[model samples]
Target: MTLATAAHAPEGGTTAPAVRIRDLTVVYKTPAGELPAVSEIDMDLPAGTITGLVGESGSGKSTLALSLLNAVQPPGRISSGTVEIDGLGDVVPLQGDKLRRVRGGQIGYVFQAAQNSLNPLKTVGKQLLDLGRSHDVDDLRALVSEAKELLGRMGLDGARVLDSYQHELSGGMRQRVGIMLALVLNAHVVVLDEPTTALDMITQANILEIIRNIHAERGLTTLVITHDIGVVAEVADQLAVMYGGRIVERGPVRSVLGEPRHPYTQGLIRAIPRLTGDIDQARALPGRPPTLGTIPERGCVFRDRCELRMSVCDTVEPVLERHADQLVACHAVAGQEPDGGAPTDDGQEQT
Candidate 1:
């Protein structure tokens, strides 16, 4: 499943998508009712770069990742949308074997917690060799040796580590194996869901660099789902800010992280604990985001939390609108301000 093998994959005669999704909606069919996890999300990630999806815990960032693999983890399912893979073919309402094929063959995932993800009973080398064998890779001896070299590249013993169990390796080392497995299969795209969250800052930096290098050298597309602004700053070319199951802002990473068109986006950046902030003067957002299970049906879901909420926000669900180079889904940000008298960020009437 290494990148070298991905290059020669049966063309299936079409182009490659790396991953393309549109109008994707995932909803959990709750006993009480339904909880929308992701709504009307549209995203396109091509080959050779990483797109970062940033948001708080319930912001549905991880849900979007699982949707790609059709591994919606129950109580949840993709309600609608199209998920297409470029080189093989389109798999919109993909299901059964079609979805399974798309997952391992073209897409791979690095789970958030590698320690728990690795099989406790199996040795690391056995796992790698087995995966290679399943993919019909011919070189058993060479692949087994390569696993060691790969571990070495990540600062571990190729052979010694191979015979070790998941619990035996350090946190950082387990994560390294998780990453290697994702790329070793030469997956066209790797969905890294908070993959570095468990590592220390130093280790996190190293992992991100590894991912960056892999993308550049292998032309692999990556989708990094995280909430850490620093992580997005380091690896993302595109950034999507999620709130209440919707993408509130998305565009060039620089613009979204720097200028930050939406108030929510701004508040998030302002709340980051910067070293430059007064030692005791860390910033904070005023309120909480909406709960996915019981969100208000109408109006902006962020209204209760938004510093710039207007009366109109109580009734209107804002549509995604283009502003400058970014897509912002906010009535105020889209300039459909309420009462022609919506309060500004400073709580003053517009001139």
Candidate 2:
């Protein structure tokens, strides 16, 4: 299908964001100095909508996702910003049990690599029960039954899968189990970080289907952090493009994918391979993505690689500004395009 048509399109009417992050900056303390992995980000994941955070590796996508649940490990901390979940209030200051409660309950997490995240030695039922236990769900039988029901919903044979170990299932089944656990924990918002990684194309499609199905049935607010634009196009209602520790572009999935405004976003879309016409024409982006240690401290972070860079971009950092349907941070995009020069599919100025 097309990116414009999501099976579970976010319903209009909800004005409040399920998760609102304002000026979020995450810093990792290194021997070299403080490294900002996420810098001054302002974003909103609307209630009951699937918002995709897409970028190349080291673009702070995972860092932003972890920050949502306050799970950023030591050495990396939320240096500043407010993380407000719709019903939970501000999480920046929450600590101890309060913070623990928010995690896995209010906000569920599906880490990358299901094989690595699951305990290989533990039975599926045992693991699910342990997760439930953490959320004050102590009744073992009840937890197992609930887990089975959730697994069934995810297309697994509830009883058969529950009794088995992680190694017993195929890669696709394990991945779905990872998703099922997140839903079973009863989280209002689920953060899935690269859930489709290490899977074949068919398996990837299956996983995406599972995600859309679960979201539709549960009405859970979802944040899918991925590097694949194609995957985000298939599953997300809205798309946010992150680069060099900041959100460079964000809008409705169709709008951003159809007419990307940011130069980095343009590069990414240009790089996606088309199956039919001109399949070999896909171009690779030049240069590597900047890491926390390598990114410069001032001005525009993407200036080094942007082809549309202007002299003003060298000295002044471009704040994210509204342009049509999306928010973009780039001097080239912020300036007015001459009349009749519309944006192309890859966000280039079309004469």
Candidate 3:
């Protein structure tokens, strides 16, 4: 489906958003000082749709996704903001059984290294059936049946691999099994962190197609964290662009992909490989994103790498402002296009 069609808010929809995160900040207290891995990111992940969080490594994409699952890596803690699940609201501040139920039942996560998520000692079938047994599966036979079906759907040998251990499966197969595990939860939201990163291009595409199909069929709200723009274009209805530790651009994928507002977003679009002869016309922003800890307090985080950097950028922080359908944080983009929309290359305007 087209992005515009998929980004639709329901007509008085009954479900609270699958996930609503506001001003979410994941930080750490270090010998140097307080450090922020992910800062000031706000987005509403509606049910049954995919929202792509795109950024470079160390840009805090993974940190943000992990925070949603309450699974942030070592030394990282959520310093502020709220994470509200569809049925269980305010996940961050919650503790104990309520948090457990909300996370494991309402949220399913697929990691980049699917192999790592599974147990090498157990049969794949056991791992896949674990979730189902907790909620709906009444007996061994029932859980096995569901596991088999899920495996088959992912193009794996469901019946055969059911008895096999993790060491027996290929990398791609292991990843598929990881996806199957998440599916068995019947989760309201599925968080995929570069699920296809370990595969070849063809495998990546196949996985992407499967994810899209699953989301559409189940009306599953999905949070996909990836370094690839192509992946985002294929599956995302909504986009959240990040840099350093913050969201710099967010909107319908069509606009953010077509005409980006932040320099970082513009740089990202330019970096994607083009098949339609426009590859050379694409822009590439120079330099890497700044590291999180011990960072300079003054100026925009992207100033050193921004082609449009100004003297004022060194002394001020930009706030995300609404422009038409998108939200952008940039000093250069502000007010120039008063309509709050991106400028078309050919002098055309869209609102």
Clashing pairs in 2: none
Model 3 whole-model lDDT (C-alpha atoms) = 0.77
1-351 in candidate 3: lDDT tens per residue?
Answer: 123433464433225246878888898777776798887777777666689999999888999998898777667889888887867777887777666665657788887954487787888777656655555556768667776887888787789988899888877777777777777667768899988887888888888888987777667788999988889999898899988888888888888888888888988887876778877776566776788763457778888888788888889887777665677888888757766644443222121
**lDDT by candidate, in order shown:** 0.76, 0.82, 0.77
Evaluated with lDDT, which candidate comes out highest?
2
Which is better, 1 or 2, measured by TM-score?
A: 2
In model 3, the Cα lDDT at residue 245 comes to 87
Worst 10 residues of 2 by lDDT: 342-351
Clashes of each: 13, 0, 4
lDDT of 1 by residue, 1-351 (tens): 122224322333123355667788899887778778898777766555578999999989999988877788888988898666667555656778667656666788988853477878999888888778767778878777766766787777778888899888887888888877776766777899997897898989988887776666666778899988899889887788999898888777787887887888998998887678585565688877777755778888788888788998999987655554566778887664343332243231121
Tens digits of per-residue lDDT for model 2, 175-201? 878887877867879999998988899
Ranking of models by lDDT? 2, 3, 1
